[model samples]
Target: MPGFAAHSWSACGYSVQKVYEWLLGSQQRVTWQPFVWNRLSLPKHNFLAWLFGKKRCLTQDRLIKFGVITDGIYYLCGAQQETQAHLFFDCCYSQRCAHLLQHWLGVYWQGDCVYWVIKWRCKSLCKKMIVMAAISGLLYCIWEARNKCKANMVMKRPEAVIEHVQAAIRWRLQRSDFVQQKDSTIAWIRDKRLS
Candidate 1:
């Protein structure tokens, strides 16, 4: 075999896993995976975040590509073409919601909120999970509000969305078992008024 090497051939013969890896090359871990799939997050929130990470959410730009809609204006802001980046990061509505949530959580993220959440440093993993859950909830709510606006339903105000996310986070924390939580983690929950 012209392209084959001795090391490439295993004595036990080829396996599906080996073939898959060879075909796909080395798998690089996504930075947003942990942020999207945090155990403390709700299922819907996790799903929405995963869609966001994959850029699979049906923003108006994608709809235009599909010819389902001719116009691509963002329903939330109505000031620019609707795009994954614009809707999630650049839109004033989303930025305001994110700002309020970040302020409430006493954290500031400059860019790519999901990446920021993954790299955020804190003494407690529990606190980190709480933050991840909150961010996930915020993303989900923003998408919901956008859809509502597109459908001509009453869209929630950014402050209202933040309040809803905060209440959801607090409710989730209340149901979580805290028996083995560290003192710092409990204190964080208390300080955030999530307990």
Candidate 2:
């Protein structure tokens, strides 16, 4: 703070605004922010972080530990003790959803860890952002599905959740300015279509 220099402007001469923009433009932010913030809509993005972090008492295991509901193993499949990882990654319903989702996006997501997958580097920023959105959407929709299961409502199937994931990514891409400016962005889409 003592070395602060408002007198010295960025080389582009855009002042502090340029510095802030440059800071945010780094590849590291591209890897992480879309998962925690930016890209996706507000509150949905916020909620995704909370859900993926397993901070809420939504999972069956968490509820059981908290002594809430004692019976259900998992809301979606009712197969295994519901930890966040099991419910979202290992559940049959969710795994089917992920498979269909990968087909829809024309990408196979590697890695068992969500954070690892989210941080997986891509040459195309567009693809990176899309992957981030998919991860977030999958978690959100799964959590929402779990909630519906608890409420005795009609539960969405894996296909339906894949549709939700596609819709969310499509909507985000349609509005993303970065996608328009980045050449690498279009290559993933092009390759996806060709494949």
Candidate 3:
């Protein structure tokens, strides 16, 4: 063990790696960043991210498998099973949302899966935050819209869904002052300023 030093980077005098080892144990690895739990972060979006990363969100396929839903078909397109892959990536509704996001953020991305798209989308930290905010908001909006469609029999257009995402991310940015954005990026997302 390292001897305690008053100015040690870690309070217990262990290095950052040791802290990670202690927290995650020997087998599991944490995929999301530590900054994800910042005070101003959106709890709903964060929760959705947790479900999404775990592939535990109740997609139609999972519901059917659990005998909660009769059919595994996607409501949006009716052409494929509403598994996590279909709902978040392959279905037309999701693809339309992706296109709208790409246009709004002035970026081009291509991947058959959500994880791949998110992983290789951008290199800049500031841009990464913007993109993550967009993706997170979009996921929340899509899932809500899906539920509403089932309950209220109303399926929103891709444009309407994108508007919902815009509102959500804008509101979230206003609430969080931690992640500052560049002027150009702010202009791109159309947010007046970083809160």
RMSD of each: 3.8, 7.3, 6.4
Better of 1 and 2 by lDDT: 1
Clashing pairs in 1: none
TM-score of each: 0.81, 0.69, 0.75
Worst 10 residues of 2 by lDDT: 1-10
Whole-model Cα lDDT of every candidate shown, in order: 0.82, 0.67, 0.70
TM-score of 2: 0.69
| Highest TM-score scorer | 1
Model 3 clash pairs?
Answer: none
Relative to the true structure, candidate 3 has a C-alpha RMSD (angstroms) of 6.4
Which lDDT tens digits does candidate 2 get at residues 73-157?
7767877788877877788888887777678666687556457656677676567666766767877788888888878867898
Best by lDDT: 1
Kindly give the stretch of ten consecutive residues in candidate 1 with the minimal lDDT sum. Answer: 1-10
lDDT tens per residue, model 1, 47-96: 99999999999988899999999999887888999998998878999999
